[model samples]
Target: MTAYLTVVEAAEHLNTSVRFVRRLVAERRIAFHKVGAHVRIAVVDLDAFVQAGRVEAITDDRVRRDLSGAA
Candidate 1:
C-alpha cells in the first residue's frame, strides 16, 4: 500500500513549513487526495513533485564559461 502523509508530515519531509504545503494544495500545485474532508499526499506524488522540479547541473564547459563571463 502506498503511504499517505498529512500536511505536517509532508512539510517535514520536504523540509518546508506546513503553510507552504497547504499553499501548494490550495494552489493545486502538488497532487493530493481528499479523504473524508482530510487532505493526504502520497509519497509517490511527493517524490514526483520533487522530481519535476529537478534541475540538472550545468556541466558543459562552454555554457559554464559563458555564464561566468569568461572568454
Candidate 2:
C-alpha cells in the first residue's frame, strides 16, 4: 500500500505552504490523487516532483546582468 499525505501534510513535509501545494496540483506540476474533495499526494511522487523541479543555483554573470537590467 502506498502511503499518501494530505495537502497540508505534504506542504509541511516540503517546508512550503498549503496554497503552493494546491497550486502545484492545479497546475498539474505534481501528481496527486483525489479522494472525494481531499487531495492526496504519494510520498514517492512528491520526492520525484521535487527532484525533477530542482533548480541549480544561479551564478551566471550574464544571466544576472540581464535580470538586473544592467546590460
lDDT of each: 0.97, 0.93
User: What lDDT, from 0 to 1, does candidate 1 have?
Assistant: 0.97
TM-score of each: 0.83, 0.73
Model 2 regions lying over 4 Å from their true place: 55-71
Best by lDDT: 1
Over the stretch 24-45, how does candidate 2's per-residue lDDT look in tens digits? 9999999999899888999999
Candidate 1 scores a C-alpha RMSD against the true structure in Å of 4.0
Task: Give the CA lDDT, 0 to 100, for residue 20 in model 2.
Answer: 98
Task: Report the poorest 10 consecutive residues by lDDT, candidate 1.
Answer: 55-64
Clashes of each: 0, 0
Off by over 4 Å in 1: 61-71
